[model samples]
Target: MRELLVLLLLLPGPAVAEEAPPAERRTELLYLLRQDCGSCHGMTLAGGLGPALLPEALSDRTVEGLAEVIRAGIPGTPMPPWGFEITGEEARWLARKLKEGIPP
Candidate 1:
């Protein structure tokens, strides 16, 4: 009985730890929104060499559209392709996080 109890407790530890880290999601989103994007979109994402991506400006675009842009890259502009650097899934995650909203 004690061995079974110990096994049950041990099983949950790995299961709980396997959960994705919220910090990772936030960090990746911030990096994409700020650093990686700042090169053209401006430091605050308000607007710069690239078009603004703030909620107000991006209201017309859906998360999927944003993912496609990230995956395919905008043509005829300074924004280079990121599909090679980050996977489509990662891009989708970033798009969802950004569109869903995040703290400044």
Candidate 2:
């Protein structure tokens, strides 16, 4: 019963959907991912000033948690909130991609 409740909570509701950001912005976002984010995360996302963003490194992180970090930024760290530049939906999208490995 407890496990069923947890599973249900994790399931996406029919009325709640998280769509990807506009296609037009993908180019820009990808650039940010490489240049801005890469500045710390590493050009190859192999960990430099910041921790790695590779799928293997992010295997334990939750999409929602990553989205929160993207939106709110980490305190006492170099990471800053990009919420103004990127929407919540877009942040979520990025989190998913980071977990799956961003394509070149």
Worst window of 10 by summed lDDT in candidate 1: 12-21
Please write out the lDDT profile of model 2 over residues 27-71, one tens digit for every residue. 567678888999999998889999999999999999889999988
Model 1: residue 49 alpha-carbon error in angstroms:
0.3
Off by over 4 Å in 2: 1-18
**Candidate 1 overall lDDT versus native:** 0.64
Tell how far residue 31 is off in model 1, in angstroms: 2.1
The digit string of per-residue lDDT tens for model 1 on 1-104 reads: 33433343344332244322354553555565677787687776777988877777777788778989988887987777788866766776666555644434
Q: Which one is best on TM-score?
A: 2
Clashes of each: 0, 0
